[model samples]
Structure formats: C-alpha cells, structure tokens
Target: MEKTQILPRATEILPVMTAVMDAVDEESGKGQRDEATGPLFSENEPAAEYVTIGCSLKGGYRLTGVIAENTGESSIFIATNGQTERVAKVYHRYKKPKEEIIERIKSIRSPYVIPILEEGEIAGRFFEILPYYKNSDLLKATPLDAAFVAQVVVPQVNAALKAIHQAGIIHRDIKPNNLFFSDDRNSVIVGDFGISSILDDRQSVRLTTASRTLGYSAPETAQGFVSTESDYYSFGVSLLHLITGHDPFLGMTDQQILKVTLTDKLHIPSTVDNTIAQLIRGLTVKEREDRWGYDEVERWCEGQPVPVKENANRVKNIRPYVFNGEEIMELDKLALALAGKWDEAMKHFARGYISEHLLQIGQDLASTAADYEEETNREFGFFKLLYLLNPKAPLCWRGEFFTDLVRLGERVRECLPEINRDYADLLESGALLHFLRTKQLDPAVVDAFARLKERCRTDRNEAYYKMAFLLTGSNLMKWRGQLFDSVDALVGYLHANREGDIDAMAEELVGSKYFYAWLEHLGYGSILKQWRALPYGR
Candidate 1:
C-alpha cells in the first residue's frame, strides 16, 4: 500500500504474459511425432505414452521413456503391463521434496486423492510414480454443469482437501490442470502435489505472489499474503471456474485483478442452486478468516445443514468521498460526451449533470502544466493523484486524453514547417485537439492540414467531439482552397427528416462509403481506431 510501491493504475491494464505450453498437442500421449531421445527439445513437442519405461524408482518398475526430452528438465511416461497403469513423473536436475511429507501423503487414505505409487531419488533430482487415471482431467472438461459441480466436483475435492489438510499439507496451486477424474465414476480427484507444502516445510521453494496462472489464487496471496485460507479461496475460485467456463479475473492485469477481488462483489449465477451459491460465497469472501475451512465443507458433504451468516471477518465496503460540487464527479462522462460517442455513457450521468468541478480542476491543472518548462509524465500524475485523492472521481477520461494533450503541445513547440497536404492525419490529430481545448482554430493548424487529399482518422472519443460536430451539423466551408463537405451536411439533413435514425445518418455521410453494423458511418472509424491503445475497461 506504500505510495512508492504503487505503479501505474490497474486501468492502465497489464500486458499479456508469455503463453503457456500447448497442452492440446501433448494431451493424447502420442508424442505428436516429436523426437523422443534427442539432444534438443522444441516447444511443439507432444506427450508420449509408452516411453521412459526404463527408469527404476529405487530399483522397482521398469519405466518407459515415452516422453524423453534431451534438453528439458521434466518428462512424463505411463507404465503399464496388462493390469496396472501408473504415470511416472521424472524431474531431472531440479526437483526437491521432503521424504517425510511424501510418506505422510502416501499414508493418508482417500479415494479422491491421487495415491503416490512409488518415489525415488536417482541423482540429485527425484521422480514419483503416481496412480494415473487415463479417463480425463478437469482441464478437458470445461464449462461443467452446475449440478455436476455441486454434487460431484465440490464434494470430492473437499474430501481430497480434508485428507491433505489432515496430513498437514497445503496445495498452494489448485486449478483445473491439477484435478483429474476418477476412473470409477464421474468423480474428480486432486493431483499434482509438485508445488504443495507440508505444515513444517520451511525449506520449501518460495511460492511467489505473482506466480504464473494466478486467476485461481486468493487476492491476499496475490498481494503476497499466504495461508491455508488462501488455499480455500483458490479452491472456491476453481470450483466457480468449473461451473462457469472461465476465471472471473480473466483478461485483467495483476493490479486490476487485485482491485476486483478486493472490492467488487463476485457474481454467482442465479441458475446455480442457492445452497451451492451460498457455499461459494462463504469460501470466497475477501478476508481469510471469513472463508470456510475444511470442517464446514465436510459437514456440507455429509448432508448436515450449516448455517450461513454474514462473515464478521469480511471487510466492509468504504464508499468514496462525495464531493459537494457534482461536476467533478461527472467529468469522465462529459469527456466522452464531448467526444461525440456520448450515447452509451449518458445514462450513467443520469441527467443530474454538473461541470463546475471539472472547469475548476481543468483551470488549475492547466495553470500548473504551464509552469513546467517541458512536458513530462508528471504532468499527467497530477490528474492521477487527484483521482486517487477523490475516490468519487469519475474515471474522468480514458488515460489517452492527457497523453494526447502533452503530445500535441510538444508538436507546437517543435516549430516544424507545415507540410502542404490535405487531410494529413498526424497534423490534424494535434490541430483537432487544440480546437477542442480552445474553440479558436490556429492558422498553423489549418495550414498544416491543407490537403493533398486523404481522410484524417482517429477514434479517440476526446478528439472526436469537434470532428463529429464538423461532420454531423455544419455546412461545408471552403477555407483556404479546401473543401470540408464530407458528412458536413448531417445535422441539416437530420433536422429536415426530424428523425435521428443512425442508418440514415450513415448514408448521408461522405468521406468514405463504408458503414458499421451499429449503423454509424465509417467516415470517422479510422479516427477511433487510433484510441485503441488506451486502456479503457471496455
């Protein structure tokens, strides 16, 4: 929570991380025609079934090298001889485990737990032969039905968690990839204890808060707080994902994910059984102490009624400060309105429109900005700090507007000769911004855009208001030997028809013939495309 530790806002959004290994190609255990015992390994390598059968685990079953990677550290191969089938997980060069914990896992008895058949340390690394259920894993069974999750998945996984916890261990990572179906019924069993830890396993590998595939991780863990309750939170999330097809935090940055998990109320589909919904609610509350422990899960699985109450440990919502002047609160909506893409957001401003706060903030920030000899990221920090200070502040604008202001201002200071061309987009982008800021258009701005003839394009809603104004309602102006006739007749035509039919609007528009299915003309489509870089949640 330290200010120095804070980075850009979550709405800045996080870039996507490197993609995970393609499990699809390797799921069939056929090696996907890859070289098994070579001095090299590739990303496209597939899973093989009958290889690596020669590895003896402390001198026991003959393991096949079905998946022999000459360049990687891990390998998987199935061992079967007419009756028994088991998966041999070979970790080469870099795997560590406490023999005491592995022994405890073997001693714990549970049908929903993947039994460790045998394990051994050949070199510095170790390998374990686990009971392999050839049926399927949860990763393969996406979008499971709600009934299946409540009756089959949740109970079985709860049983597994009970057994693991009883053995004083915690499955730090609980996700689809770590769950497999039992060979007997449609029941699921917990597997992959590779990253798991025993209660006293202090020498264990440090499980980072931001580890890859964190959607199922608890919010506290994402912020570097870890506990058994964190595991319960993750299990709850995994269950939700099974019932619903995707992670709730999908496509979000780490920061954004934290914000959502911490503040937003999670949506449990109404179609799900109310009991199941209540169970999930109990498990996923933000506070660790509020989450359901294995004891509660056991009681539910046993058909005993458990009372659901408001968690005393759950954090209370703190509403953002309300500013007396309403204008500041609605500046974000106004920005969008001014951009001409105002229809969708208008409902939010809710007709109680105000702008005194924005006009004041704009004036103050503009004055402060003038004091800077050179434009820098700090110029924008003022706005961001204002947003943080006033929790009630409307998003105020997509992050793009402030950056565009600085960029355009720099162009003015550069004092480059205006290129003689018609509808040159780059110069026009800046010129249009200047007009929006101060209604009077500068001569240099107009001359810089004097045409050799091409359409200027930008979709930034902030930039569009004036351009939209010129397109929709104004008559053509022959200024300095250039024509502004395209779509310029829109407003007059609308008044003549008295109907604001967008389809009709599209037809009357001129710069380009293309139109969107939304019925908006594409004359300004190219202009909007330029704003795609801005991290607006939508």
Candidate 2:
C-alpha cells in the first residue's frame, strides 16, 4: 500500500485553486444552469476540482491534491492524513442526507464492503470518505477468470449482499463500474451506494425511481420495479460481463433490452463450465422469484451445486464470419444494420428487402444496449456490412498482426498487382507481418493499410492504426520473440513471465478489448494457427 501523504509542492496546486475561486465567485449560486431546472442536483452546480469547500473533514483528513473526477451528482477526490488516505465521494445537494446512507453502509460488516471512515457536508454537497483503492475499478482495469469469479467476485459480492440484505438494505445500483479492487488485486470490493434503499421489515422492493443503468437491469426493474432480487439480477449481468467481456444486452435500447430480458433467456456460450453456467443462469432468471439470491450465490461460490438452468439460447449453427450472405438470420441482420449506408444494408435485410420491419426491430434492440457495446457492435457490424457490400474490399490490409508464417517479402511481391487493382480479395489473409523485428515493416503493408484508412472514417480506421502502433511503437517483438514459433519457446516464456500462472496470462491476453475484434478482422487461419501453437491456456 502507498503511504498517503500530501503533495510536498503545494505551490503546483495554488494557481488552479485560484482559478476555481474566481470561477466560484462569479457564479450567482447556479454557475452553469441548464435551460430548465434539472430534476436532480438543483441546489448544486457541477463541482470544479481545486475549489476548496468550507466544511472541515472529520478524523483529521486533508486534501492530497486538486485532482478530482466530477460528474453532475458528485465529485470524487483523494484526501489523506499523514498515515492513511481515502477517496472522498462528495455529492451535490439533494433531498436525502449522506449521513443516513453512511450509517446503513456502516451497519454491514463484510470484507466485500468498502469501509467508510468519515461523512460530512461541504458547502451543501454531502461527502462520504472511504478507503482509497490504488488501481482503478473493473471499469478500467479488470482481470478475472473462473477462479477469480469463484474466489473473489462471486463470494465477496454475495457476502456483501448477505450482510446488507440481512440488515434490510438493498444496493439499488450494481455494475462493473461500482466494483473495485484493492492495490494487491486480491480483494474485490463493492462500493458506490448512491442509490441504495433500506427495505422495511417485510423486505419488499423499496426504490420507485426509474433511474437505473440500462442493460444491467432486470425485466421488471426497468419498468420502475425494485426488490431484494433486483441486485441479484444486476450482479448476474455484471458476472456475465466479467466472464464474457461483454453484457448480453450490450447493444440494444432500454425498451428493446427490457423485451429481451423479459422474453429471451441469457445466451450462455457452450464453452463455459456447466456449473458456472448454471450459476449465471439461476441468477439471471427473468422472474425474480426464480432468481438466485445471497444463499444460492454463496453456495455456488463455495463450490456447491445449485439449480441448473434448463433453458438457454442455443446457437443453431455458428458462423465463422458475421457477414455471411447465405441467409439473413437474427445475427446476420444485426451485422447488416451496422452498415454505414441505408441502401446497402437494406439490400440484404429480409425477403423482398423489407428494411422498414428490420429497421424498427434494430432500433428497439439497439435502444436497450449499453452505450459502449452499442457503439462497438455498430462499428463491427458496419465493417462486416462493408465486406458484404464489396467482397473484394481490403477491410484488412495485407499485413495485420502475425498473419504469415512463411516468407513475408515474397508474398507481398506476389500480392502487389492485385492490391494495385483494388482486389484485396486477391491479397491472402495469411500474408501478415508475423516476424516483427524493430521497425522492419514492409512498405507494401504500410501502403495497403494507409489506403484502407483513407477510404474509411477516422474511428473505423483506428483499429489498424492501433495495431500498427502496438507492433512498431511498443516492444511486443522483444516480449513475444520466437515464442509463437515453437511450443518450447512459448512454454519457456509462459514459465518465466507468469510463474506457472498460464491461465492468468491467457486471461490477460484475451482480456484486451481489442484482441477479439482484431483476431476476427484478421483471418482466423494466420493468427489462429499461432494461437493454437501455445501448449496451455488454449
């Protein structure tokens, strides 16, 4: 743990503080009010970092620096005494007091609950201070495998929930963004109790507001319902994301998401262990009555058998690519809708090109999706749609990742004429820069990638650029070396780098947000061959 101490050079923050003071002085109470008074945070304006509040913190806590992350509702800042530090979550003025919530949290004594040290009001904004986690939460830095889930997340989360529910408190909001890890990366704590509600002795649904995060919500919860089981459903969604690196309802509208949640079962991939799958299945059950609660969750975490889910979305026939023109199924339509142009996408929509019908379905489905997932799905779909529209388009340049095993120079020499003719189909997917030495890039690959980028939007073109940067700007060559060339080398690197944590290394490799997309965009043959070369963590 890093010793919590104030920045020695207070001079560095003085200027920023001065600017904030000036800005605050100019405000007539509402510094930057919207056209109409927003429902939440009416008495308060957005917090500016470096602007000191009048309220003194309890327990001799003092500001470490001016660096703070502020949203509409609250500002998060680091504060510390000489020996200890904490994250102060200072909220704008609202009806409910922070003291009440603090007491509720304090009542729960669990390893999973992030401990609160102090609570006070600062210039009307209520601030609650808790132990500072060194690394960012699962939102930014998440590393989980089956063991991680079984040992850390599932057990801890359930323990916290058990303690809270026992005390008649329901954590209204639960998601990856709210879960955090300790500096050691061993303890995963659940925090952010901004919307938690205490249940009556009867233990009923307490919250009535429809302000919950989409995609992670239960079917009834999205319709302004909340209960003890609500958190369980949300945790199931979070669990799914932790395991699969994505939410099931990631790219749909709130309404569409609700429909899917109400009607469709979670599409747990066949690859997942039957026990783990059953746990997720029980938790995500559409009916709150059927859903797994703290007891079930705790049992599962303790390696006990739970009720196996009988129903799940079985993939009828898996496609190697998302853009197969063979038939327009649910999956194919999703990919098609992501296409940039209307006409091209509609050309393959349904029988007689009934785009309007498909368009409405797409809109509703997309509306329920998580914002980031929607964006990614849309972009990937567009890329796939483009490929469908023009089979010959060089969506991928000749060289991407480690696509080639044999002579790279000779293959490029052969593919030059086809590339010049804009026949990217002629450029073999297997001919990529596998043997990456320091800055030894083939000009043909560079030219081909540049040409592809010029034709596409900047955001769409970034994947290739990022890949290139990773290859050239970073020391991937020094790290990977001839590991992919031989099973022995791969094993040696794994043994040396991970200390027998091959599964951890595999999780790290696949955990990268860009890995799956890049692998998919790059042909399965070239990189898949190398990926298959590994001895373990396959």
Candidate 3:
C-alpha cells in the first residue's frame, strides 16, 4: 500500500483518536488482543478475548469516544464504569488543579453534591473524571414556574442547604447556578462547592472573606462580618429574586447595593403577598439580632397567614354609630349646653336626653374653643354647662377644660384686677376659685356659676363674658335658667364687638348660638336671633 500524505488537520485529529484508544486500552489492560481480528475488534463481535480473570466488572466499562466538544484546552469524554454504567466526565490536563479539587471532594458523603470518581496524570498531564449530571443547572430553569420551583425544587434546595451546614461547610456561593436537578426530576443537588469553607469543629460557621454574589449577601457581610445569619440573609434575597424574577436590589451599583443592604431598611413591593413579604423583610433586617432564625422561618412557613394589604380596602367599610352626622349633632348640642351655652340655656334644658355622643360633643366644643380666640369665652360656657348637666363627664375632657380655663384665667388676670366690683367678686368667689385652685371642677361647676351670678350684679364684662361662655351650650338643664341674665349681658358685648371686625365679630356671635339656643329655650329667643345675624347664616 502506498503511503498517503496527511494534512495538518488530519494530523491533529489523529492524536485525539490515539488518546481515546489509549483510555480504552487502559480499561482492558489485563486482556490479550485476538489475532484473528488483529487490533480492530469487529462491530458486532463480543470482546471475549479482552475479559480479565476473577475481576468480573459487572455493567463493565464502555469507553465511547469523547461525546462532547473540548471547549477548554483539552477534550472531555463520557465513560461508563461500575455496576450502573453511569456516565463519567473526563477533563484534559491543562485544567488540572481544579480537577484534583473535584477528586478530593469524592471523600465527602453529601447526597446533594455531585461526586467525583477518579483523577490521575494522563498523557503527561493531570486529568479528573466526575459523574456526568443528567439535568441542567437550576439557573437554566424559569423562575416564573412556581409549580416546579416552590412545590418541588425549593424544599430540596432548602434541605440541601441544611445538609451542607450540618457538614460544617459554608457554601459561600449559594445561588441558582450552583443548584441542579436529577435527570428524573425527582431530586435536587447543589454543586460547585469550590468556594465553600470548612468550619473548625469547635468554631462557629462564619466566613472571614467576602465571597458572595452581589445583592445576595447579608448587610453584615458588607461590614466584613459573616456568620450563619449571613447565610440566612442571602437565602432571603435569593428567595426574593426567585419570586420577583429580578434582583431585590436591582438598579443598584455594587457599592450602592452594599451600602443599602447594610444601612437602609428594605421595602417589599405591594405586589407580593404580606406573609411572604414579612418573612423576607424579617430575614433582611440590617441588624443580625433582628433576623429570624431557622426555627422562626419554619414556623412562619407552616403557619402561612394571608397578607394585611390584601384586606386593607375591606377594613375601611366599617363605621360606628358615633360617626353618624345626626347623632353627632345631637351630642354636640348637649355637649355645648353642658359646657355652658347660656344663651340657649332654656332650649337645651327642655330637649335634654343625654347620650354618649353628647359627651363627645362636649369635648369637641372644648377643642373648637381652644382652636379659636373669638370662641374661647363661648366654649368655656359650653364646658360649664356640660359639667353641670353631666357631672360624671370623662376626666380627660374635664382636664382639657380646666387647662383651657387656666390659660384664659392667666390672660385675663391683670384685666380682672381693673374690672368693676361685681366682676372682681365673681373672680374671687369661693366656688369658682376653689374649682380653679383644686383643679377638680367636676360636680363643682354649678356652684362656680352661682358665684358668677353674685359677682355679675356689679361687674358687667366679667359676668357678661362668663354668661356668653356658658350659654353657648345647645342643651341645658333646669338650673341653667339663671343664665338668662348673663346671656343678655353677653349679647350686649357681642353687639359692641360685632361691627368692629365683621369676621371676628361674626365668629364670636355665631359661635355663641349653642348657648343662645339654650337661653332661648329658657326664654331669650328674640335676643339670640338678633345675635345670629352676625355670620354663618345664623
């Protein structure tokens, strides 16, 4: 036979074929070649001549040519070995140290991690062989497929993480790319433990070096503190990414992401259900002490509660009776009278049937009085009437009333000394003074009013302002009848102050209607209506 010239490509292809032959030859090392067939075995012929004695390798070695392209500097081959004829991965020499590391991992007994089979120098360089995985990396799966991930994959991944932690190893790179499913989709196994750290038996699980994907590391990790809690934080972020199909800290730069994860509080989007949102938020807390532990997480997952935001709109529909306008108005009138609406004293007294709302109205009147300067006197009267009608009004309302009274008393203290004798007597009266001093006016407001009556005989301004303040109540009791004289006096003050500042005067006069009505009920309608023309359409 004439020798044929071989091109460079043909020459290059020959070495790969030779390497495959060499591997196959090593497997049949104990056997002799059959002379009849030369070195080339027939396609359908059984290799009985290549059988080794006593070592019956059941499901024996089947050396097939490299099934995949050599993407790296060397080629990879799939060889079947052992009982099941499981696929074996063969890596060429240039990728040696990593291959050796993979081989070292074979000593580990983790079901979740892929196991290495054999490693040694081949063709003057090192090579490693790992069991070829049947399924793709979890990264290749769509996160949106909830059925596959939540119901199946997630539990397995969680279990795998727990297993890894138990083995005293911290897989610093826990991410989708490192997880894989079995060919039958029956199991999940986490791989690529190259970056994992082995914790010292006595020491806790902690990472000294920062070796995590951005946006998934715990806030503490950014500060160079890594512990088991840090792993929980990363798991939380990973869960968020799976649910949202985007990084939780998306749009953030590496530095920004670290800054926020460490300092800023997290905000879960409204789109997520509350239970899950809260769980994730709890895990991502900036403080490690704040983060939930494994037991807490388990409890939450098992207890599974519906989110608060889901029921937010429904909660707004509930309203109590006190919120009704008609009921509120009735209560307001009563409160106003009790607080001392002297002008409408008789009117309120005749229609009186107090309700809880009435007391609330009294408090409202007091608040309104405190809010406006012009209405201060009128509000004081309303407060007095309320105290007189309902001696048992809440202490809170009474406290507020007394506070307002004290403030008003301070403002008028200098003026009181200059006022006429009648007013001075009213200010000095034992009942009013006692109530003012003791700060306990409940059940004493009536006597206080009587003292006002004796002083009004001479002091017009003091008695007038007092009467105006009391008669502002919308309802009144029998004793309020004495306020008619005071109501008349207050009306005079209103007329004097009315034309000076229309708005201020209007507010003062119209503000007194509650008391005016009470007085009208007591027989002063003519005067009450005359004051009503000031503002707010009476």
TM-scores of the candidates are: 0.47, 0.48, 0.38
Q: lDDT-based ranking, best first?
A: 2, 1, 3
Candidate 3 stretches greater than 4 Å from native: 1-110, 119-131, 205-207, 249-251, 304-538
Which model, 1 or 3, shows the larger TM-score?
Answer: 1
Candidate with the greatest TM-score versus the true structure: 2
Q: What is the C-alpha local distance difference test score of each model?
A: 0.49, 0.52, 0.45
For all the candidates, what are their Cα RMSDs to the real structure? 22.4, 22.0, 39.3
For the record, the alpha-carbon RMSD of candidate 3 to the native fold, in angstroms, is 39.3
Q: Per-residue lDDT of 298-417 in model 3, one digit per residue for the tens?
A: 556567542222111111111222221323323322343233323344233333323322334466543443333232343343344444432322211222222233233333332422
CA shift at 56, candidate 3, in angstroms? 22
Task: Put down candidate 2 lDDT per residue, 1-538, tens digits, no spaces.
Answer: 1111111112222122223333544764432212323221122333333435433466677766443556545777778876876777777543234456668788778878887777876654667788888886776654368778777888888887877777677787789878988889888888877767767787576534324566676765533457889899889888777776766776775434543564557788886667777888888887687789987887777778788544345222232323334343344224323332334443333222332233344655333232312333343333333333222221122212111212222233233211222222222221122111112334554555444444334343233423332232221111232312112233344545544554555555444423333333322223334334434213
Report the Cα lDDT for candidate 3: 0.45
